[model samples]
Target: MKKIFFAFIVTLGIFEVHAQKEFQGMAVYESKTSTADMKNQMGKNKEITPEMQKLIEERMKGMFEKIFVLHFDRSSSVYKEEEKLDAMGGQGQGGMRMMSSMMGGGGTFYKNVKDKMYSVDKEFMGKEFLIQDSLPQLQWKMESETKQIGGYTCYKATASKPVNMSDFRNFRPKDQSKEAGKEEKKETEKKTNFMDDFELPKEILITAWYAPEIPINQGPENYWGLPGLILEVSDGKTVILCSKVVMNTKEKATIKAPKTGKTVTQKEYDEIVMKKMEELREMGNGPGGFRGMRMGR
Candidate 1:
């Protein structure tokens, strides 16, 4: 009955909001990065060859260009990728696995303002993890700045958080992990072997522009708690910007939490990933003898 009622409401173009003119609809975001900027960031790296550099840059441009959708009503929203198996220029898989996690890649994100809880589907080392966590409380400072994105007037807000290199890549470098473990620690403190190995930056700042006209506090990937719908988000190196919005359209969709993964809180998921990654590193480090012993752990 509830589903039928929602269908009827969608038919009438009304769901939750009383103001018919107000937006209770969907927004499409195309996340893009400046290829030139990426090429520049890579200029300092010693690992990429000049020939490999050209191929990798083209691959980066092809891969990072993505589409995300925001299906929002008054107080709830679900953001996910619009699936497309893009051509990767027929390039072979590179030395590293996908860096999508750094890109905030494919995850069904469900947010509820009333409940103040969020869930994300994260895949790590062939395991799908359902991460349930309390909504991040961001201390945002709204500015007098304004801009127009996809025909909507937007206001600016800024916040910052600590960041880590592992947060951007699927796996931590085996050498980096070893170095982190060498640091001394107090035995009384909970061991950070699985946790502290990855190095983190002092901070990452987020600058987002939201549309007050829309009035939905939602945005791509874990960014929310704003007064309006977030249209563009920047984290220094990457940016997710809303390219299109369809207000009150007949595209039938529902926002729901994901199921059927190893259910875990965010902290537990991180620990599990580290344990698996360590196993992989150890397995690769071996004559298959010490590797087997470590795997037994």
Candidate 2:
């Protein structure tokens, strides 16, 4: 029995190698984020009632649940959101647009494992940016646990990623004391602006599941470097799961980098976004401006 099991493993390895030589596939992933934490944070505000909270959750559900497609070959992949019509007839169009910009959505992400590089075509505040950067190096800890996704056997891997300060999903409301001295409150208000009401954690844990049968080291979004093709990923707040996979389709997908924006590196892009947010805060905090407005309110 031991020899048979070893032989089976060897045979699977051989098949995986052969598949990798000519594998080309498209995978559909359904992504959804849990807004429970955000809601709880916002619940601190006395202005929000139970009905208001429910309404907010409903709107956020529509904004956070999304579909994405990953077009991948052996060494490269292109991941992007699958566009869909708004069910509310564009009622919350502006909110959706803002959420997309804040979450880094509606972009073309191209990754080249062979070159250890990635390129993203991102549009923020009506400006296009081509962000080119080296792929992030993650120290993945592989686990002995196994599961099945879309009929493929998968293994578990986990890694820690630094939280991006600019990502609004990572924001948490600041704790303020209502009983502070008037002088202290005035000093705090003078030193800080609306943007200071939120803070981001230092890091987030990323859990992924990869299927060795796929024989490609690719994944949804910026995750990769596993022994196989990643089929699902969870970062505590959001969960991305593979719903369907089409292997070796008749129409091959074009896996090329985008080139139609102001070129910048990842760091530069983040700085640009931060600068823009600061500008908005200044504009909104001026006389008769959009002040005293909390996020997600």
The per-prediction tally of clashing pairs is 0, 0
lDDT by residue (167-233, candidate 2, tens digit) is 6666654555633445466554443233344567678899999998988888998889998989999
lDDT of 1 by residue, 1-297 (tens): 999998997967654345633446888888765455345434534444576557555545544677889888777788988876646433332211234543566678888776888888866555677888788788999999998898889999999855533354222223545556655553345431322333445577889999999777788877899888899998765688888887786765777788757888876876665565567555553111122112212
RMSD of each: 9.4, 7.6
The candidate that wins on lDDT is: 2
Candidate 2 lDDT: 0.76
Query: Ten-residue segment with the worst summed lDDT in candidate 1?
Result: 287-296
Candidates in order, TM-scores: namely 0.70, 0.78
> Candidate 2: lDDT of 70?
94
